[model samples]
Structures are given as structure tokens and as C-alpha cells.
Target chain A: MKQKVYLYRAFERFWHWSQALIIFFLALSGFEIHGSFSFLGYQSAVKYHNMAAYALVILIIFAIFWHLATGEWKQYVPTAKNIKAQINYYLLGIFKNAPHPTRKTVLSKLNPLQRLVYLGFKILIIPTMVLSGLLYMFYRYPQNGSIEGLNIESIKTIALFHTAGAFILVAFVIVHLYLITTGTTITSNLKAMVTGYEELEDTTKSQLESKNEVISAEVNNE
Target chain B: MKKIVISLVLIGLIIISIISFVSPKETKQSKLNELKAELSKKTTPSVDHSKFPILQKKIGSPQEVTEACISCHNGRAQEVMQSNHWNWEREEFIKGRGVVYLGKKNAINNFCIGVEGNELSCAKCHIGLGMTSSSTYSYTDSKNIDCLVCHDNTETYAKAPEKGGAPDQTLDFSFIAQHVGKPKRSNCGVCHFLGGGGNNVKHGDLETALFEPSKETDIHMASSGMNLGCTECHKTEKHLISGKMYSLSSMNRNRATCEECHTDNPHSETVLNQHTYKVACQTCHIPVYAKVNATKLDWDWSTAGKLKDGQPYEEDDKDGNHTYLSIKGNFKWGKNLKPDYIWFNGTASHYLLGDKVNDTTKALVINPLNGSYNDRNSKIIPVKIHRAKQPFDPVNRILIQPKLYAEKPGEGALWKDFNWQRASEVGMKEVNLPFSGKVSFIRTEMYWPINHMVSSKEKTVQCNECHSRDNSRLAGLKDFYMPARDFSPVIETAGTGIIFFAFAGVLIHGVIRIISTRKRKMKV
Candidate 1:
């Protein structure tokens, strides 16, 4: 059993859960706007999307401020410790109940591989969407003389970027949703997010002892 | 992280502001208006603008003077005002205020003395306002201008010029309608150039052959009085002025030129195949005199006192029985790549008032005319005997690309093999139009409806896997089927499947640990 302290603050939990909700709705409405579904028809989907975008921006601002004030931003600082080990365990070892190579602590809520994944989402996907969406929304009514440097007669490039970014964002959401279900207890991690508390072992010392004995007996039988 | 986010936001606002303020289009519209106002002020005269007296009854056409003669000579007062003929008519001034040549008639007025005087010649023509003959020309102030030239021909001042006279050196057909057909008649070449001989009429379609667009164009010099422009009626003929007579149609009045009234272009609006908008008429019609007569146009305006049209200054030359132009050329549209501006040349004379005479105050409409020129670059030269008699410009431009629409896809749908064709007509007999053809991609390829942009929220078109790709664990487009391209499958069988099973194992481990933790907490 591994032990872990109360690392995630109330604000952190709030930011995480709220961000997830916003992104989920954003993906839904965005696809709706892209003519993917009819849950909210084209017009309503666009309305909801625009509203969700505004709300996401507001939530991000608060989260940023909270992260800055609390110095809790260090949790997502990506490092390469046990990175290969983590990959291998996910690829093969986990089927035999192989233990995680990295442990969680109050100072570091995410493991080495988790840090890399979080960094990619923050650096690549989100910023791409923000820039592309803003360009698309306000690029209108351009007269020939107004922007001499720009070819206002054509908007193919901007549209292409906006559409491409949308596909990437959707792709990321699909993967994220799948991985969420793969958490510690199909419903347990989900419950923890809802209740803001996760029960766990105090240390991996007992877990390692039991596993070692089981391993030795299996080897002998083989 | 907090500082980084804030900075990014502020940077975006700054960038947007810079883009908004740097546009240049606002300056051009104002400049065009200013140029128009300046040109109008400089070129159009303010004198002789008097109120015309209204008469009660309409006068009947003279039985002796034919309708052909009536149209050719009608509005001579107005036409002369627009030509160089007015220059010769001006009363010579020895000094400042007093008018000389007051009672003296110039020998250039040949039309009144010629043999065709009553037979389609200027001598037999009705002199409208300023001349001395027409013994019954009861009007006074002989130099002012007469409306009776065409309106009241019986006044007697009109007549055709005689043989061996200076080319009736009088202004004729100075202004013409645009649509007049081929063998151009009076519309295009008459005032466009001063060709042909003294008493011999020039250009084929006589002045009476002109008609409006709404009317059918008469082909031969003898008109059927159809609605067609001078270009349509005259075609290639350089002379002839006797034919059927029709009342002139009123101008559209929305604008004086084709451009102002035709901002929405017909050629591009229909876009039958594919093409960009056509250029405005004036853009390529800039004035060049060589383009008028001789060719291989050259210029030395860089030097002073340079003679334009260097091939023997033809005017007032002793040996000039008129050199036969070796190169015969036809009139056609000139090609112009630049689609924006038109530079034109013209002059306005201050003197030559028609007739300061009897009840001539009927007001003429002051139409703001835009100078028109056919682009000659696209037209092939017509084979003809004389230099000026050949066709000079072409009317239609068909060398442009067509359009392809995504949604409506009337003609555009044909390219992508879209079958929006009328489904009911497949079994019908005698369907002249085939709803399908190679343009519809009927054969050669079977990938129909491949590039359709039906990204609309139709469940029939939307793929669930496409929308949900990002929601799960696929890093990129790791495994998905696209209908547009050839695809063998995303995940190969055997080894890859084994790896997927391993991923499933990790998920199961996580789930069991989470379950065990919850149970232990419950016991405690």
C-alpha cells in the first residue's frame, strides 16, 4: 500500500474539475458547430460554444492566479525520471499487476509520464485553439485599402487553421475520455473527483513485501 | 504560469489593434469623387444654358426630305458643338471684344451647294440653325443655332455639298449609341474617325439604321427598324445613311456610361462555366491616335516638339492625294490586363454656338457621358480594302476561367460526379439535355461525391468516430477511416492487437487498486 498526503488543494480540485467540464462541453458544442451532431443545432451550438469559450477564459484566469499565488504550478513541471519504466509498465507489465515505478507525494501530484502528457496539452493543443479561434471570429468586413499587406479577398488559410485545430482538439478529448475510464477503479477515481478525497495505502513497503512473496512462490512453481 | 497567461492575452489585443488601424482603402473612394468633380468643372461649359420655350403642337416631317436624311442631319446644332467643325465656324476675332467674319460665309460649308442636295447629300440637307440659305429660314440671329435642322427642315437652309468640294467638312454623327451592330454604320467610325471622301458617304450602316437593344437589328443598309445598337445594325459597313426610321429610345438615365449602371456584371453573375469579373470599358480605351489610323505605336513625348504619327504629317501636305495605307486592319477589342483605370482624351471648344435664333430655346438633356473604347488586344484584324473600313474592336471576351460551387453545384457539381441531376428524368423520353456526362464524371472514375463539403450537422454525413477521436486516448489520428483517401486499416492485426491488450491490462490494474482502496477504507 502506498501512502500520499493531501496534495491537491480545494482550489486545485476546483480548477481541475471546472476545466474538465468546460473542455468537455466545449468539445461537444464545437463538434456541434462543425456540423458533427444535432444535440444543439447549428445556431444554438454556436451560441453555446461562444458562451463556453468566454467561461473557459474566465476560469483559466482564476486558475492561473491561484497557481501563481500558491506556487502549486511546480506539480506539472515535466521531468524524465522513470519515464521508460512507466511506458513499459503500461505497455506490458501492468497485465501482471506490475507496480508503478514512480510514487505520488504532496510536492509532486503527477508521475514522470503524467508530467509529459500534461505539458503537451497545455503547450500545444490549448494555445493553438485560442489563437485560431480568435482569428476566425474577428476577421471580417475587410476593405481592399484597409489592410494593404493582407489579401483580404481570400480567407482560405485562416479557415484551414481553424478547422485543423478543431480536429486536433477533438482528438485529444477522445483520448482523454478513454484514459479517464481506465483510472484506478473505473468509478473510484471518478468518485474521488466528485467527493474531493481518495483513500490509499500509507506506504508501498507492505505492498512490495506481499508482491515479492507471491513472485518467489510463482517462480518456484514454474 | 499566471504571468505567462496574462502576457499572452495582452499581446493578442495589441496585435488586433495594429491590424485594424493600418488599412488603406478609405483614401481611394474620396479621391475618385474629387477627380470626377474636378473634371466636370473643367470640361463642361457653363455658357448658352438658357431656358427653352415650350411649343404646343408637333410639326410633321417634310414630304420631300426623307427620314434617312432627317436622322443624319438631325440635332446638327448639338453635334457641331461637339466637333472640330465648330472651330472653323467660330467668328474670327481680329482683336478682343468685337466679332469679325460676322457676315462673311466660309467656303467649308459645302453641303448646301452639292448635287445630292435633295438626294441623300449634305447639299440637299436641311441646314438647322446657323447658315444663311433656306430662303424660308424665317429664324433670326443666324449664328446662335437652329433646332429646325432635323425638327423643322422646311426652313430651307439645309442642302448637300457638290462634287469636287472639300469633304463636306461638316460635323456628322459625332455621337452614337453603343449597341449598334457590325458593319458599324454611323455609331462607331463616323465620329471615331474622319475617313471617306468629300461627297461620298463613309461606313455602311446609314445613320437611320441605328436602334436600341430592345429592338431587332436590321442587317442590310436598308433597315427593318429593329431594336439594335449601331454596332449590331452596321456590322462591317463603313458607309450608307438611307433606311427605315425608328424613334430613338430614351437612355437608361441611371448613368450616362455602361459602367455606372452595370456594376453588377452579367458575365460573372451567371458564370456559365468559370470566369472572373470583366474589366470596366474605359480601363483599356486610353486615347492613342496611331490606334486611330497607322500602327506600330511609338512615342517620344520625352522630347519637345516631337511630331506624333510620324508617317508624313498628312494634314496640309502638297503631295497628299492621300497615300494608300498598305496595311489593312479591322477594328476589334484591345486586350487589357489592368482592370482598374481608364485614361481618355477629348477637347471642348468655347466658340461655335449653333444659332442665336428663332425660338431655339428647347432644352437638351445634359447627359454626363463616359468615354468608351474597345480593347483591341483580344480581337483579330478583319480583312478589308481600306484602312478605316475594317472592324476595329471586338465586343465579347470569352478567355476566362469558370467557377465551381460547393453547395449549389449546378454546373460545378458535374466535376465531382455529384448526381443532384433531376432524378425523375431518367426514364423520360426525348430528354434533350442529359443530366449526366463526363463533366458529371460519368465514366473514367467511380469515386463519386468524394469531395463533398457536407460538414453540416446531418447525421447521415457525420461520422461518430470523427467527433470522438480526441475524447479518448489516441494521441493523434492514430486509427480512423477517411473516405477521401485510400486506407488499409489503422491497427494492423497480430502484434498491434497484443499491445492493445496490454493497455487494457493496465486499465484493469488501476481499477482493481482503486476498488481495494475503497474497501479498506470502508472496514476502517
Candidate 2:
């Protein structure tokens, strides 16, 4: 049996949509600056890319604060449980109409594979992109009488790293979009993200609180 | 959700409104108004030379007029005598060769060779009179300095070609001396505009077009714009000009730069201002040279001896430019040409006479502008590279300085006899350098740094001109990484491959799931 339950909060839905829009705009403008194709023109592309970068940084800051305050960060913590089953389901069992390796609930929203992938993106890819992008924006060509140690002779390494990060992020977005269709219905995940409500497995308020408490206790033991 | 969406739309509208209101239109209007105010504030001369009593007397010869001028303005002649214009050479300290005197007298250019045995004809551009021969012309003589050439505002004083730099006998010296004032554009343009034996053949930036230029030709010298004179930027003090050409100069001293007047941080945008450290003002400002006239691009002396009906002849292109001359050579000209860019640090090295040509297979750089990306003082600058194929000694491996001009035939001038052997013998004897008695054509290049005919702000080079993937102006510059022009091939391939594979994987997986779901439904 299933019941209609609030899966995403208002702020979470807003953040998700805003990030999706910003990332798409960034990829379009970023590739233009990378000399892939000219759409907005080089000067306009640079200006808008920089503006979007600032917007993303602000959004990320708010998202981070919200996650920490709500204790929702624990959803992305990796665990070995159901990891093999999840991999097998995607590889072969999905064609056989097999059941999902794990169930989604308000207490723990992500599966083991999702947790690991999301954590890698949060800690590695996003941070690298942001840091390298900031360096690209702020780095100055050393003029006469400039400080010796502050001299950055070349931007080759920084640019290459930022470009590589962009490629990885683009690949992640492709897979993430595909994974959205693997829900109970083709549009279920999309509808949930938009309305903050989905038909999830039934769990009463008291049952969800107990499950959250048990997960917190387990985390403390580790 | 509705409130958030509405508020976001309102915020975007407000931001766009603010950006639209604060446009650059107002700034551009204010700048134009400021220029108008500056143009109206002209300096009124304190004294009129037309009323002077000394100029009322009869001026017989050009030297008599000069004497009368010296009598009133005492010690001014001494100042003009010490200038490079009067001497035609200066003491420059080359890097490897210390304390060498370099000038048109000693410097060997590919055009018309040199001025060793052809002083009579080459003296047409000289500032002094009586340069019949290089060996006989006295540099210490102060009387030879022609004061009226620079100060005559009458615009009628003309130098007779091949007459030892003398004034035309038809000119009224008395009227010119009476009307003398500050030098006009015509005074400097007379020789400089017609250098290398033709109009606009030498420096692409300087030509007759600058005399009364339109705004499109040169913003600074435009009659409708700033109307600035040559001395405005090439500031002169005691007759010693501050500007130095890399063709004759070797040291990084007394150079005229745009930064001298306009600050280094001239641009409103910090991103553009940062480019000042590595890019010169002229690199973006002067997009192309030879704005109104076609300048000489290539000259091949090997084809000079071609004659018709046993007589020297000349051929002209459709544009009235000289295409070939039996005395000179085959010529190629270009108009409104995009300048080549190179890293320059204000200093240059020249190929001095008697210097051995090490590489015979490649064109020799007559004046190699010195700098690199590693040099802190270096900046990318625009240049007009004039290439030529001139005569050289194959055995001695030295660029031969041929005597190109003679008043009559049988005088061992290439123009008169069209004999390379006789011309080379006389040229080598004049310069006192061994010529190996053998002459052959060798390719050579000369770099003329573009400095004038700067366009307005609207006509300046855009960012994509140097930042685009194809046909970038800075394509030759590979030392530093530019945003759109440079990328790592390996990283690009790898990144693209990953995206392709991920996209393919998702597409295949989606197709297989659909096929299996249909099969299960059919069985049920």
C-alpha cells in the first residue's frame, strides 16, 4: 500500500529547480567560452557566465546551510547495505521487472549508490569547479613592481582543471536525468520535485520519527 | 510557489531596468564634448614673423635667409646642428657590439640598398644641404642646417631631388623667411610621406593622407578631430626628438608611448585594463595600416634588369601605383592591411654592414625586434613586415650594398648600366667591404613598427579578433594560454569521450527497458 506524502520541502524544491536552470545556462555559456560554438557571443558569454557563477555560489551557500540545519545531510552518508543489489538491478535485473534494492522514505531518501555519487559530487567535483573558477576570475597578470611571490606566470593548468570539472559535471547531469525515469512512474520523480509530494510507501509520523532516531543512534555508534 | 516565481520575475525586471538606465551612451557624449572644448582652445601666437624688420630685406640665397634668422634667434642653429636630422647618424650602444654609430648613412636597408655611393640622390630627404658625396659631406658644418625647412609655414619650400638636398631655385626665400612660424604637417610630411622613392612606400602609417586626414584615416591627426601635429607625441626639446625608430635605434631609451599621456589603466573595465601589462595600446587601437594609400609590401631586385626595346621603362597598376621599374624592381603593394603582431620590449638588433649572413636558405631579419613571453618588460605590438629579395655576396656571405643611382651612364650605377658586377664593385669600394666579386639575390625582411593612424574607440579591434578559434590576430603567439584560442587536445578528447559514452549508455539502457516491458506485456 502507498500514501501521498510530502517528500521535498518548499525550500528544497526551489533550490533544486534554480540549480537545474543555473547549471543548464552555465553549460551553454561555458562551452561558448571554451570555443565550442558561438551563441551569445564571446563578450556576452563571458559576462553572463561570470554572473551565473555568482548566482550558483550564492545558491550553494544557502543549500549548504539548509542541509546542515535540517540534519538532511545524513541522507547522503554512504553505507555498504544493498550496494551490490542496487548495482545488479541497474545492470540486469531491471529488465526482469525486479524490485528496487532499497526503499525511499523521509528518514533516508537516497540509496547507497546515490549516496556515494552525490557525496563525490558535493566534496570533489563541485568544490574543484568553484575553487578553480574563482581563481580564474581573480588571478591577475603581474605588471611591473608587482610582488614576486604573487606572480602567476600561466593560466593553462587552472583553465584545464576547470574545463575538466565542467565535463564531469555535464556527464553527471546526463546520468542523473536518466535515473529520474527509473521511479515508480516515468514522471513520478519529476512531479515530486515540482510539487514536493509523491505516492510513497505508507509511514505514519511516529514511525518515521522512530526510524530517524534509530539511524541517528547507529551513526553515533560509528 | 506562485509568490516566489512572481517575486523572481520582478527582481529580474528591476535588474534589467537598472542596467539599461546606466548605459555607456552618456559617457561617450561627455567625452565628445570634452574633445570639442579642447579643440576650440587654440594657442594664439605672441609674435608675427610677417612684421619683423629683418625679414623685409632682400634674401638672395637660402643661406642668406638662414644667416638673418640666426642673427635674431642666436644659438638656435647650434641646437639643430646636433640633432640626428642634421647628422643622419647617432651613437647607439648595441648589446653585443658596444658604442656603434648607426643611422641611414651606415645602416643597410633592403630598399635601394644603402646611401654610400648614392648620397647625391638619397640626399633628397636629408635635413641639410650639400651632401654631394658621403666622403665629402662635413657633419660639423653648422651652415648646412636648413632652418626654413622645419619652420616655414608657407608650405612652398621644396627640396629638388638628386640636387644634394638643396632648395628649389624657383622658391621665393624672402617670402618664406617672412612667413615662417611653427612647422605644419606638410613640413614633416614632405620627406617622410615620400620615403623609399615613392609616396607611402616606406612607413605604412605615415602618408600624404595624414596632411588633412579624415577621422577614419587617423583620429588624432584628423582635421575634424584632434588635429594633432607630429611634435605633439614625438615631443621635441632642444631639437632632440623623444621618439626612436627600431630600424635605426638599438637601445630602450627615449621612446614615445601612449601611456605617457594616457595612464596605463585607461579602460573602464578592469579586465581590459589588466591587458595593458602584456598588450600594447596600438595592438588594439591600430587594427590596420595604410588607411588611404597602398604601401610597398614586397620588392624583388632580381627582376630589375628586365627591359623593353633596350630602354629602361616603368609599369603602373590600375591604381596608379608603380608595379615594376627597370631601374628598381618588381613591386607588390597593399592597402588597409592587418598588421602582424610580435613581442617587443622597445629594443631591437640590426643587421649591420659586413655582418655575415649565417642562414642562406631563410630570409634574414634586417632588424629583429627583441623580446619574449618570459621577459617582464615585453608586450605584444603590431608591425608591418616589408619583405624583399635583394642582392648579396654568395661567397663572402654578406649583404652587398650596390650603388643604385648615377647622374649618367658608364658611372657604375645599377640604374644607369643595369650591371650588378660594376655596381657591386663601386658599392663595395665606397663602403670599404670585401664583396667576393659575386652577386646573388637573397631574401630579407624588415619590421616597421606601426605607431600612427590610430582608429577611434568605435573602430578598435574586438575581443574575438584575437580570442577566436580561427584567424586570430595573435595566432603566432603560442607562449601564453588565451581563453578561446588555446586548449589541451588530450583533455578535450577525454572530456568529450566521457560525455559521449554516458549519453550512449543511457540511450541503450532506455531502449532495452522498453523492449523488455513490451515483451512481458505480450506474454501476460
Candidate 3:
């Protein structure tokens, strides 16, 4: 038997979709600004990129607060449990229609490999992009009838790091689009994110129900 | 129902971000004023010339004013007499020619030719009185010296053109003599700003707008900042000015430089400081020149005699630049111009009067800056290039100084007779040079160093302006390779080849995996 369970919250779905839209716009406009393409024109691309970047910053701030308040940040923590099994499942077992190594629950949504990749983006790549972009924006400021801000020697390094981060995001998005189709069905993960509900196997459902009942019973006795 | 509220919040955040980006930019005038007050800490003059009793006497001529000035300040005229301002001559030791004499009076330029045949109009800029090409003015005489030209604090005193360096007779001499103080901007700019016959005609850097310039026009000489005067940098000792004109002298001992104040390492960044050794300070600092007025860049004497019904015809271009003039020539003027970049040390090689030049096909370099990229002491500098097609002596292979104007109508001037031979003959006779009598027009080029009208640092050149893919400013300049703009063909091919192989490998591996998975499912 299988049962439907609540997986994603309303704000979680909102933040995820909004952040994805912003990143997509930023990447397209950013590449145009780097002289990769010329569909939007250089000046317009720069303006759009700046606007999307600001919106992304706001979304990130809201998402960070929500994660901390709801204790959902724990889902991104890397663990050794079933790590090798998850890697092997994606590499070879997925093509043979084998079972997944780890099961998803409301409290723990991501597998070990997914946790490590998301954590890398959150801790390293995002910060690098934000820092370099801000440096480029405020490089020159009018002070005392003269421009005297940002005593940096050159903008070459900042440009290089920003470009590298953009390429990494491009690769990550391509792989992510393919992985979302590898659920119970091709549309399973997408439907769960949209409707805040997912179908869980009978064994996994019984295990979660027993864990909740024991915690509630303990709280009642205390 | 909860998703609707989340969507509204996201929309609200985007609206706020856009509003912040489009907010109005505020001007910081008060901050500039505070900075100006802080930088203006120089000491005032100690002596006041208004208390002198000899200046109270009546004066008719400029000599009378000079006599009254030297009555109080003894030996001042002797000091002024030793300066080039009084002699109008400079003697330099050239490599091929020993001890060559060169100065404004001795050199032949493209504009207005030289001071010969029409010295009265030219003497308006001269320091002494009653100077003519024929008459020998006494330089040692104290009465011949004009003190009011440099010491006039009153803006009223001015030397009228064709009056032979004499102040206008209408002004009160006693009041001007009493109000005498240190030279102001207007005093020095009276001649310097109006050189080469009119305002902003000769030098692309110096102009009348520099009288009280804004910070954007000139950071150092801005009225809102340090507010420097002409004498501040071109410091004078014993009445001898320190500045040297590149057209007049190639090298000099008294040349003032920006390193005198800003030092070698002015920028905080080590990379920018390293650039100072290879590039000139003005190359990056003074990005453009001639901001206030359009400067004349080219003149074609071949098109000079265009007439409309026996009257001189004149026409202006779409930009209001004088394109054709019967009195002068066809002129091309440019405003806010980008300078041509070149390598220059502290010296230049000049084509002096009567110097034999070859290569009539290309433009003759009247005076070329002496330096190259391979030289250690040379730095990349910006210069205003002035090109012209002027009359030259083909037989002698020398540039001719044609008398362009006359005080009276019958002086055999080029404008009067429309004859280059008569003007060249008269000019050569007056200057004591051999006349070939055979005249021809040749293309000539001159370089003027751009050092004034410096903008703030942020408005300077960007990297892509010089290091771009096509039509870059540094396109013809070899010796360095620019990244992002140029790539090595060998390295590029190797990198692309590796990427192609990696992509093919991934495609084959994924296809094999899919086929094997389908075959196993079919067997089961």
C-alpha cells in the first residue's frame, strides 16, 4: 500500500520557484553583458542583470530567515549514511530500474550527495558571486568632487571569478533538470513541489507513523 | 490560499529593488566646497605696492610706468632683461649643429608664419615697447621694460593689438600702478591664452575657459579646489620662467612635472603605481583636451583664394567649425578631442628655420617628440597633432615663412596680393634667409603636448578603449599582447579539440547505458 503525505510548505514552494526564475534571468542577462551574445544589447543586458541581482539578494535573505525559523536548514547537512549507495544508484543502478538507496521524509528530504552539492552552492559559490558583483558595482564613488572609492588596482580578478561562478551555475542547472525526472515517475518530484504532497511507500509510511506516535506519547507522559 | 500571500511579498520585494535603482542622483556641492577650503592653505603676498609715492605721478607711455616701477625696485629691469621673455631667443646645443639659436622670433610655424614683415601686430605679445622688424629696441633700457604686464592686479590694463605692446591710453595709469600686485590668471592669460592670432588657436590645452575653471574642467586649477595660478607650476626665478614650449625648445633644465607634487607612486594600488614607470601621468589623467573651445587641427593653404564677386568668402561646417576662409585658409576644428598617443622622453627634435628636409610625399614633421618604446626613459604620452598644407621652397627643400598680413593694404602680403612668391620674398629678406623663388605647398605635421584641462580619475579611459578586438586606439602599437582581446591560434585549437573529445565520450557512454538497460528489461 502507498499513502500521500505533506512534503513541501507554501512558502518553501514560493521561495524555490521565485529564486529559480531570478537565477535564470540573471544568467541569460549576465552572459549577454559578458559579450557572449547580443540579443538584448549590451546596455539593456547590464540594466536587467543589475535588477535581477538585487531581486535575487532579497529572495536569498527571505529564504535564509525562513530556513532558520523552521529548522529546515538541517536537511542540507551532509551525512555518511547510504552515501556510497546513493552514488552507485545514480551511476549504474538507475539505468537498470533498481530501488533508491535512501528514502525521503518530511523531516529529511535530501540524500547525502544532494546535501553536499546544495551546501557547496550555499556556502561557497553564492558568496563568491555576491562579493565580486558588489565590488564591481561600487568601484567608483564621487567623493569631494573626485571619484575616490574602491582602492583596488584592477577589476580583472573580480571578472574572472564572476564568470567562473556563472559557468558552474550553468552546469549545475543542466544536471538538476535531468535528476528531477529520476523519481517514482518522470513527473513525480515536480508534482510534489507544486502541490506540497508526495506518495510514499507502505514500509516508509509505517516507519514515520510509529516514530511520530512514540514522540507524542513521551510528550503526553511528561 | 497561503501561496497567494507569498507571491505578493515576492512582487513587493522586486518593486522595492527597482525603485532603489532608479532613485535620483544627488550632487555633492557642499562637500566640494569643504574640500576646496581645506586645500587652499597657501600664504598671501607680503608686500603691497599701493603705498609707493612714485606711482602717483602722471604717465603717458608704457616706458613712463616702467620708469616709475624701477624707481622703487632697483635692478628688477636688469633681472627681467636676462630672461628669454626680453631676448626672444634661446640657444641650444644640438647633436649635429653646435649651439643652435631657436625661439618664437626665430622659428617658422604653420600659423601666421613668423614675426617678420608684420612685427607690429606680433609685438603686441612682446614684453618690450616699440618693437619692429626694422627698428632695434634697446633691451638694456629700464624704460623699455613693461612691468604692468606681469605685476598688474587690475584687470583693466591690456596691450592693444598693433599698438606695439602699449596699454590702452584710456585707462588711468596711476590707478593701475598703485593697484599693482602679483600676476593673476587674466594677466598671464592675456597673451598665452590668445596665442597664434586668436583665442585657443595654437595650444589645445590652454584656453580662456581656464580663467576660473570648474573641478570637472580641471581638477588642480579648479576654483572649487586648489585654485592654482599659472605661476604656481611655471615658477619664475630672476624673471626667467621655468616652462619650455616643445615647439621652441626640445629639452630644457626648468621643465615642471606632475611628479613634483604627486610623487612617483601616487595610487594606492601597486599595479597602478607600476604603470607610472611605463606611461606618462598626463596620458591617463588628461584623457581629452580642448573642452571649452574647438581647437584648429588642420589648415589647407591650397584652398585659400576662394572669392565671391571680388569679396572674400567664408563658410562654416555643420558643427560651426570654420571650413573655408579667404583671409586665412581651410581649417578643421575639433572639440573635446582624443589625443594621438606617442612615446616621449623630456626632449624633442625640431625642424628649425632653413633646415633641409627630404620626403615631399608624406607630411613633414615640424617638430617630433624624441623617444621610442625601446628607450628606458621614455613613457607613453598623448599629443595633439596639427596637420597643414603650407608653402615651402622646393629648390632649397625648406619651409617658407610667408607674410600673411599687413598693417596697411599695399604691404605685398599674401592675403592682399594672393601671391605666395612676393610674401615669401619679403619674409626671407626681412629674416635674412636665402629665397629659392620657387614655391610649392607640402603637407606638414606638428605635435603639441597636452598637459592641461585634466578630468577626475573616474572619467578617464577604460581598458577596452585600447585593448579591443578591432579599431582600438593601440591597434598599430606592437610590443605587448593584450589578454581577452588577442588569443594564440595554437592554444585555442588545442583547447577546443580537447573539449570536443570530452563531449563525444559523454554522449557515447550515456547511449550505451540506455541500450543495455532497455535490452535487459526486454529479456526479463
lDDT of 2 at B454: 96
Candidate 1, superposed: residue stretches over 4 Å from native: A1-10, A32-51, A139-154, A203-222, B1-524
Arranged by TM-score with the best first, the candidates are 2, 3, 1
How many steric clashes does model 3 contain? Answer: 0
TM-score, cand. 3: 0.65
DockQ of each: 0.08, 0.57, 0.09
List model 2 lDDT by residue over B41-89, tens digit each. 8787778887888888777778888888888888888888888888778
Docking model 3 quality class: incorrect
Model 2 regions lying over 4 Å from their true place: A141-145, A205-212, A216-222, B1-36
Candidate 2 RMSD computed on C-alpha atoms after optimal superposition onto the true structure: 3.0
Candidate that scores best on lDDT: 2
| Candidate 2 global CA lDDT score | 0.86
- Local accuracy of candidate 2 as per-residue lDDT tens digits, A117-205: 99999999989999999888877744345788877778888899999999999999999999999987889998999999999887776
Error of 1 at B141 (Å): 18
Backbone atom clashes (below 3 Å) for every candidate: 106, 0, 0
Arranged by lDDT, best first? 2, 3, 1
* lDDT-superior candidate, 1 or 3: 3
Instruction: Rank candidates by DockQ, best first.
Output: 2, 3, 1
Please state the Cα-based DockQ of model 1 relative to the true two-chain complex: 0.08
Candidate of highest TM-score: 2
